[model samples]
Target: MAPTTERASIFDPDALERVRRELRLHPQQLRVVRNAYFKTFASEQETLALFPAPERVHLDPLPLHQRLDSTLDGASKLLFRTSSGLLTEAVVLRPRSGRSSLCVSSQVGCAAACRFCATGTMGIARGLSVPEVLGQVVAAGQLLAREQRRLRNVVFMGMGEPFHNEANVSEAVARLIDPSYFNLSPGKVMVSSVGVTDGMLRFGERFPRVGLALSLHSVRPDVREQLIPLAKRYPLDELRKTVRELNVMQGRPVMLEYLMLAGLTDTDEDLRALLAWTDGLDVHVNLIPYNPIDAAPELVGSSPEVCRVFAAALKEHGRKTTVRRSLGRDIEAACGQLVKAHTLSERRAPRSDTSSA
Candidate 1:
């Protein structure tokens, strides 16, 4: 009895090329398969049919375990079961603007421990591989294709802190925008970080056209440290400097994600501090309405009126700002509301004897 060999991911260039050589297939056949799976979001059976040796290549590295669609909005949360049996999540957002987006995770769980994020509650499991990260986009794209929509944007705002898994995430981004692969425009991909200065700089240098967003929920050092434990290592000044550098490198505005937490981040002082910090720096401030997470009971989102006023004040100061529309709240797929329930649900289930793949 011989041990079974694992299948190679279809997205892996080296593996796919090796398979192509071994099968003596033409390069065009491989190109067709790749384009079908990536560009057209074709089904696995459909994609594999285009190739002579179906078993030689595998389409999905992380299989879809379950999918939850929002009854309230056009948000679908796809829960993928990793080889270790841990469930990671990706969200497909179909905004009314007609440009669909998929939010992918970099790690199974977050290590940053942001108090306002549900993913931060479950301790870090491990960083997801390049295939695991890209698989999320593939699965979501296929789903959206079924509905006659093409995914236009890929956002790293799901379960994990992307910068913590910078190496794998950057490689995944490289494949995502490669013309031979997903073929997404560099501007369509955005990586959000909790102010990891070094990773942000490296990412900007590598993918100069790709967007970089800083999760600067608060400029106050004490408040930021309280919200994100990682903030202690990278102080507010360092983060501000990093954003300025990224703006220069990318030749575009760095997105500033400011979570509107009631009494915490929505105060007038917070707005003033944000204005001063962002002064002379090219940035587009995206004011996020915090979705309530059970892990952090003390935090609450700012009211709509307050959010409106905050956006107005930023506009008055000649700053670009927008209040991000809250989506997927019903299915727990909104901002800061992913992966916590999945961990809790898995814990309550009975233990199984099945071994991890």
Candidate 2:
């Protein structure tokens, strides 16, 4: 026989207020001029009425990890695990004062297998559910509120290949952008892909206004393939074509992410290739220094001189480029490094006695 399921209540004042603020609800609608308690109750009901689909309903942030921890009598920590084979576990990082952003996964372990990436070495796991994907954001919000923070953005550059899980990613974006729920402007969100053409095209068609970023580490096909295995299937030429189409469809510039690696993809030749590839396109280059990973001990970040030269070359080609200074590196929160420590620790852990006995 199938297990019985309980219907869960969706009312949450904090989640409702955060949703209201994010959606920019009118003051008159939020005003409580009548019976204070009744007015508050009516406001919440009206908010619920705004979203007919339960999935579209934005509730107070309740992360699965926190709920699990509390319910299990502090027996275990519920880490945010992705369906994407790229990562074994994750923690939803909630910012303290800015708009809320969900750090979403695209793969379990990345098949791109970039030497400098800890997640890349882990191999692909599977894509997360549309609900699970959005759940990370909800969890972040709930945790952030406890720390007096809110979620405002969503990044697909967490642990997986968003393009590999295009369908679910699209669905999550649709639900997030729905006016009845989170109602976030398309411009505020970004979908980062490691140069997946089909997924990029599909995303453009489905949500033309949502922001897009290509995890283009190098313009040279060989270098790209070495860093991102997807490059083998969708080479630079094809990727550029898809990017151009996306720009034309959105009528705005797309973000191009360039991860600078020392003695690897930061050479003058590489800069020239990058410029040539992006020639006459509506796009912005975000130059990111490679985050060191123990998995690939030889991989090192580009020197300041090399990074500056690369950025200068892009500018000389009449392209807009900016250096993305590393944030959260002190806390091991930099790109591609988040999953490394956890993965290493897990591999070293002894097998549970229950399994052996």
Candidate 3:
């Protein structure tokens, strides 16, 4: 547990207000500090310099446990240590377009237990507090700002099923788009889930402008259940309706995320079922190439050619589709992969450093 008198997170306005009153500082001073750190992503000293008695007003921060940059691509993975000693991750994707994006985790480990995900294998842990989630954006944004690049997008697609940790993730996202904080457009942030129906619907209603991505790895009920064990509870039929409802609520195409696993999810029937399920909903189908994880060696990614054919089929059926390019292949690019390997090696390095990757 944290100290009894824990500092307010830099993102927590209420806590900051209390701190300001206690310090007997002007309201504008608080604003300046917020704008400096949250908006500008300034260094610790630079931000603290703008405040009076900076040491007294504690801005809860997450430690940078480690940094992993992929040699093959513009991808960087950041591992942060929670006060609890458990590690969580955030990944930064820098495309050539110069608009960089950050992928933040909502939980330390995942409860959904998707068979293909490494985080799931670890079972459920505590949901990340708003600070932990937003710290990733602040830190990643600072990293990008130094490179003279803009942090254009933030996606909750890192370590866990987002909807499983809905409350904290929701608060973190609100501050991200709030002008007083990160000041990002709601459109630039995305929340991806493995079909947590109630939480998914609640998110759509709360943040209509923010994009939602459903990890529909398979449309077939049996296959989905096998791949995402949570499917057994939520079921595929309910998920389809939820997507349609999300469309009506948001007035935008919900993003359908499909991971292409060779024989498991990339077959003629799978394509047909997907087309059938999304026949009327407003959704952009994103076919993703699988990243191999040691936890699930049985799950082989579909070939590039097979993925292309799948995309072509979706387009032929008049569905909006894009084959998401795999970024950060060299540095255990999959979420939780680096941390899992590092944790095992700590007990079992020869550290598996990604700089040389």
Candidate 4:
């Protein structure tokens, strides 16, 4: 008899087959477990019961480190600890109109180094495995299910830029849309990137129907580079060209994400530059309010009055616009804010405090 191979993640390609061969279970048993665990978010016992080799399987690739719910909004942020002890975040936004969305993270920390974002300050952390990314979805879906709600949308606007971890993000989206797994509609899933031209173009060519958003926080090349250092590599002209190509590839308007900041990107010249950049492209503008991070004290959020004016200016220019309402502000709703705080707190904690809960 040959020695058996050690099992891998249940999300892995041959994980189920190996388990079926080892446990001598019927194919239907494995399918049931996958569907129950991945699709239906069944309980641990219920999912395990569907497998003869339950003990041999790796059910979860991510462990729930902490769960935080916003006292001010219907937003819940989940911090998941990877096997390496590093943490990533996912946010569940339950809006008033009832269509809930999950924001998933793609990396531990970000390499983008956007001046305003907390995660970017942490520097280049490791990319998350596909299982780790998908794990956030599973955990969030289960949490929503318990509240008698369903997750309707998935957005890669959590921690690291989606295009930064292009391969893993692509694979995760594929699994999300696959009927055998999350079964999310392509239109309901949105991938946001900080203007990685090549990655954005490739994604458009592949998942044509899956929505894409360009975080075009500033249209001026210098300001954009100052805010998002990756912008220097991408530049404005090349990025706008890529966006045009994506528009043609998808046969739909792409999302243009503009952060409304007081002095950084919300000025008259900035608005004109944005409109000029968006000219002749099929795009929708999403005006995001600046969520001030202590890491970027130089940045200040635009007032509501200013945001309204900016939206009006874009709409005046015949562009479709939406001002996204801020949620979970009291809970530091900005991506990577809570995780940064928690990571710093843990690092500061005395090693002598070894009492395990």
Using lDDT as the yardstick, the better of models 2 and 3 is 3
Comparison by TM-score, 1 against 2, better one = 1
For candidate 2, lDDT tens digit of each residue in 1-357?
A: 332232222333445444445555653343331111121222333445544333434433223322222221211122454433223333344333445455666555666675557777765456777656765655454455555554567677777778778788887788667654456678877898888788888888888899999988888888788777767888788988998999888888889999889867888788778878888889999999877777777778898888898898788878999997554455455544545555555558852221110
lDDT of 3 by residue, 42-161 (tens): 888899889886765666667887888899888999888776667788899999887899989998888888888888887546798888898888889888888888899999889888
Q: Model 4, 1-357: lDDT tens per residue?
A: 564766756787586677577667787877787788778887667788877666777777467887878988889888888767667899899999999999999998899888989998875477898989999998888888788998899999988988878999999999999988888899999999999899999999999999999999998888888999888788788988998899899999999988998988999999888888889999999999988898888899999999999999899999999999988888776779888876667667742322210
* lDDT for each residue of candidate 1 in 1-357, tens digit (9 for 90 to 100): 333343567867788777777667899999999999999999889999998878878886578777788998878888888777788888889998999999888888788888888778786558988889998998888888998999999999887888888899999999899999999999999999998899999999999999999999999899999999999999988888888888889999999999999999999999899999999999999999988887788999999999999999999999999999888888888643545665676789864443231
Ordered from best to worst lDDT, the candidate numbers read 1, 4, 3, 2
lDDT of 3 at 236: 84
Off by over 4 Å in 3: 1-8, 346-357
| Alpha-carbon RMSD, candidate 2 | 9.2
CA lDDT scores, all candidates in order:
0.86, 0.63, 0.86, 0.86
* lDDT of residue 234 for candidate 3: 91
Candidate that beats the other on lDDT, 1 or 2, i.e. the better one: 1
Q: What is candidate 2's local distance difference test score?
A: 0.63
Residue 115 of model 3, lDDT score = 88
Q: After superposition, how far is residue 90 of candidate 2 from its true place, in Å?
A: 5.6
Candidate 2 residue 48 Cα shift, in angstroms, is 12
* Total clashes in model 4, counting residue pairs 3 or more apart in sequence or in different chains: 0
Greater-TM-score candidate between 1 and 3: 1
